[model samples]
Target: MKPSAFEYHRPTTPEEAAELLAEFGDDAKVIAGGQSLMPMLNFRLAVFEHLIDIGRLTDLTGINHDSGSVAIGAITNQATVGRSALIRTSVPLLSRATPLIGHFPIRNRGTLGGSVAHADAAAEYPAVALTLDAEIETLSSAGRRTLPAAEFFIGMWTTALRDDEILTKVTFPIREGRSGFSIAEFSRRKGDFAMAGACVAVKVDNDLRVESCSIGLFGLGSMPIRATSAERSLVGCSIDELQVRDVAHAAVSGLESVPADLHGSAAYRVRVGATMVARALKSALEEATDD
Candidate 1:
């Protein structure tokens, strides 16, 4: 299916994009890599009178690290981000999760910011962002503001971004001290959306006890599930098989809603989600010990 007729504008600067969005308001949609938006447009899932293309904005296309955090430009492609040595070194959880997002070609055209803005519950970036306590930066004619990942995703395909605002970048805090990260998911196919997934980041003390941990679950609810219960379960304990199982159970214990679809039932998804969380936590623990 072909997209409906619309006015297209290519903005070279974020200011120009902000102005275009402000002028068009809800009638405008921002297009970066076009990986997610193009499909929505083709299928008529989303329609807009003005298509604002910010893919050419050079300012929003690099990865930079400062202190203990890394800021990734919104327009940076997933392929680039997945392969970035800087990201692998600074934010390994993101590096581990990016490859799980579709295939190489899709990653080539998918933008990190686009994924975060799209806020697909089954996608990898949103969960990773929540796990790392990432900050989302947005711009508008009214100026700029930053939001925590938890506040950014309000619901499925919904975000706190206003109609006239554009997400410019995401800043992720790097894990300090001895840390390890892992992501696990269950999907029908290699590039398919995960039926259930988990992202885990763990920081350990010199004695190898779990100091701090972050667990993010996807494909189990309206939005990415931050497994705070599971995180708390492991904070002062040694990361072993028994502890991992306890953490996994805690991760899904309070999920009030589980999506029921042709793919699986709510019970099935919760079970799979728990397993994925256990696997991720175990992997993260192994890596932490190695470090």
Candidate 2:
């Protein structure tokens, strides 16, 4: 099957893209890397009347780091992001998770914004973004605005972005002092969507006390889930294996709402969630201590 016939518009500027979206409304769709969207189009899952391609907009193409945050352009490819030294050093959680996304070829063509905006429940970027409380900046006909990562992911294949809005950048805060990051996932093979996964980020003080912690889960929910209760457990605790395990356990204790798919049952996914959380947190804690 092929996508329904649609008008194609390649916008050179975000303003132009926004205007096109405003004009076409729900009938319009944006194309970035075409990694996820193309498949949906090929299957006739998305029937759009217009495709506004923003792939060439120079504005949406780079990684920038500052004292307080790291900002990545919406069209930045996963391969570029995965290999970025700034992302690795400043937002190590993303670095730990990126390699787990599909494979090298997919990464080269898949954009960070596409993955996060598409909001696949099993994707890596969403977990890192949500866990770090990253800010998603958007341009719309109304104006530019920033959406909190927590508010951005409303459900599977859904987001807070309106039809006229295009995500321009994703920004994650840079932690000071000793920080830890970890990600764990299960797949039938190296490049498959995870059956279950977890990401853990910890910031620690000189006294080995946790300053802040964020844990995000995927492949066990409708959207990337930030484990608030689990994160709270790590605050003020000394970063250690026992503490990490306790928090990991707390992370999945009440998660009885996961979907049952062919990959696994709800009970099995919950179990995987707990185990992955423990592994990720333990590794993150170790990394924090070493730093």
Query: Which candidate number maximizes TM-score?
Result: 1
Please estimate how well model 2 matches the true structure, expressed as its whole-model Cα lDDT. Answer: 0.88
RMSD of every candidate to native, in Å, equals 1.1, 1.3
Off by over 4 Å in 2: none
| Count of clashes, each model | 0, 0
What's each prediction's TM-score? 0.97, 0.96
**Candidate 2 displacement at residue 88 in angstroms:** 1.4
Looking at candidate 1, what is the lDDT of residue 92? 92
Candidate 1 residues lying further than 4 Å off, grouped into runs, are 240-242
**Model 2 worst lDDT run, 10 consecutive residues:** 238-247
> Candidate 1's residue-wise lDDT over 199-226, tens digit each?
9999898877889999999999989989
Q: For each candidate, what is the lDDT?
A: 0.92, 0.88
